[model samples]
Target: MKHAQTFEIFLIAPPGLEQSLWKEARAKGFPSARYTTGGVTLKGGWEDVWRANLVMRGATRVLVRIGEFRAFHLAQLDKRCRKFDWAKYLRPDVPVRVEAVTNKKSKIYHAGAAKERVERAIAETLSAEISDEAPVTVKLRIDDNLCVFSLDTSGEALHKRGHKAAVGKAPMRETLAALFLGACGYDGQEPVLDPMCGSGTFVLEAAEIAAGMTPGRARSFAFEQLATFDGDAYAMVRATLPAPQRTSLSFHGSDRNAGAIENATANAERAGLSDNCHFRHASISDLQRPEGDPGLVIINPPYGARIGNKKQLFALYATLGTVLSERFSGWRVGIVTTDGQLARSTKLSFLPESAPIDHGGLRVKLFQTDPLP
Candidate 1:
């Protein structure tokens, strides 16, 4: 395994949050990080790939560009793939899956045929088994007659974080939650409060960040099955992470549903954040300021698109706005929703809306406000 060889690493960011993911990558020591259309790209070795999977909170998945070639057609692609150095990245014993996407500009416009060629090449040349259920996946993107091969180093989406067994009807993904927190200028020092917390994604993620906990600590990554993986070296990488920090600031979450409160509490316990995270069953009308300095008050309340009727939600939003404005003075606010009209109903002063983000097939934006006067 050539651990020292550098390659282009891509961190798939949530739609419209590429800049946030890029900032996080750079801050986490990937100085070469640059934002692209769908994700952030940087140059690093195998260990850096492992580290990105381990610590990056905003990335949905990490991919490594193993190699590339020019293929005018399926036959040419098959020939090049057979001759490529599969041994460098894949082991013969492990099953592999190949997926391909091609644009019309490419001569090899049939993605299915391209995928078959690559999978056959690996199975025949490297003597590896090909299975749809394989844990290791090779992603090939063909554009302008150039086929680029990338390995999905993170098998499961980074949002899974391997915790939180329970989820509500419309749960905010941890990746998006982390990015939203960043967009609100959260630095893990001040506390975070989610009035409409669902499964406690925002509160738990904030708690983990404040504690200096690695997001991937409890999860296994696809990179471990690659040929370049070295358990001892990876162990060293994990060992070098900053020791967990203890903070007095607490993360709080509340929900109108009792089951959501229970789920949030259990999730906090599973994430080892119970001590600093507090969850209770309370409606938006019942929300109160915690006994401490004002921090961030972020929530993903029910929008008409996913949960209930739009007309009825106005009163809910209005009541929420009234509660925050009347009680939680000096606290910043971030609201995630698909409807701008619903957001405006809050009657709170909001900054300009963020870029439209894709949430569960709906386009949503983050509405933010500076600390309340």
Candidate 2:
């Protein structure tokens, strides 16, 4: 994989949110981005890969396709892997892990055997150490006898973002929160609120987006350890990012748990979003409309699948609905939950439910309502 050559870059999306991730990629200036079953793909060089890791909020991780070949058998795969140019992307000094996945349609059905062959090739040919705990990873997918090799450029998942040190039970991931915010028509110009703000994921994400803060600004990437990495060039890329802007609008989050509020406030302070993110301890019944132009009110309440009882949650959902309906006029509502009955308990007129999304282990849907009348 030459540094100058453009190749396929894949952005892994959270199972059912591929289109949403693609939309974000396109809006971020990857005009030719296309959504596939599990991710979004585009053509880019190494710098584009770095940029994607640095700025893309909705991508779980970035993978860069280095090369591919067709191999019908293990011997053929071994021969091809040994002959392939491994030194172009991987460093001799850095350790790497090879992970392979093969499907029934492929003759190379044994993924473990394939992985061993590739590992041997890289170790012997490029002199790169192979370790199971390596920070850098080489991913291989063999389907229909074609082997595609990709590098996981983002070391930790992008959701880590290197800022939040605390999280609540059933917390929303930052990547999913960004996509859900986009689904609610949040363009970083309006206010956002989360009633059950666990560790303040939604509020902090909203404030960071509004301030134009790069998601990966505070983190390091796996690509930095690869052979193609250029420290001075990457520094220049980071330097060119637009300066964080100041915003007057405040993003609010409230929860009944005082500990949760403390965690949220600490998270905001760590992310440098304390200026625009306000967290308080309050229950659903005490939730009040913020004094501002009505923007968006999004919440990810307990689904009863992981916490609390389903029968008792009906009353909680009803109370949330009653509070929002009576107090939050002109504010759009986005509720994430696994049960249709719980969403309906709100009694707020919602637009059709979104396609089911995979969050944690549950299939959750975003139920949105137009601004409350």
Candidate 3:
């Protein structure tokens, strides 16, 4: 019963990274894409939804606007929900979970009550069961007396990427890593090094991008469970993406902890990027530039507030700056830290700092420099 028509597709971006994601969407041929507070919006069909989930590297998740209606009260909400063509997008055999949010302006102030009304209506009218563990989900948002419905086409946050099972404390998410790399103007043609690469996130992501691999190729999506899903057609669409290309350059990572290096190596192997990414145990004092074309050295070094003492961190940052400046001429640098003073202690002439980004509750920013002269 699902009809083919354009609908608003929301691609969620991390806070303060909306402009980077918008550029990515536009470069990927979604020319009509526009930035929003926490994401980018564009008009596309279900196929576009699948593609967005599969190809977008900077997006945390993709939501498709399924339908909308105005309901002033819970009774009207239930009445309108029953009339909705649930069969068009949901299968009777598959379980679904419904979540709702309500604003004070709406007559239905209780989100739990609104969710219960819709759940009952779907169960009775469509004969579908509700389960907390269901892969498919329906989301409702009521604001200013208008109710909007959306489907979370991405079941799990896209940052999982189905490859990185190991992580250390205060690790960066893959989505954020990609956005940071893109912000640095990484085109995947040059080498990338992460001196503090935990779990090999930046190194592995760089390798995958360099090889033209789709971020979601190794994973499944919630769209596969929808009633209108066409596995064969979707497979063809995936096939049409640019094939992986051979790269002469290699990505690199290093850490002082042997366990961290092991985890990074294992993660890279699992992502089938071990050949392109290499990891070793080394301290900042022992660091040396790898032999390759002048490319990028991107790192999320430890900050004062979380991992180490503020007083001691200044020496560490100064040492990093001394090493990169002496050994890495012609290579660009991107350092992520929460404290501006800590970043300044490095003595690296970083360009104007990027907008403060929210990383797990703390405000962080990236400070970069042009190729060292």
Candidate 3 local distance difference test against the native: 0.91
Clashing pairs in 1: none
lDDT of 2 by residue, 265-337 (tens): 9999999988889998999999989998998999999989968888899999999999999999999999999
TM-score of each: 0.99, 0.98, 0.97
Off by over 4 Å in 1: 1-3
- RMSD values, in order shown: 0.9, 1.1, 1.4
Model 2: how far residue 244 lies from native, Å: 0.5
Better of 1 and 3 by TM-score: 1
lDDT of 1 by residue, 203-246 (tens): 99899989999999999999999999999999999999998888
Q: Which RMSD does model 1 reach against the true structure?
A: 0.9
Off by over 4 Å in 3: none
Q: What is the lDDT of candidate 2?
A: 0.93
lDDT of each: 0.93, 0.93, 0.91
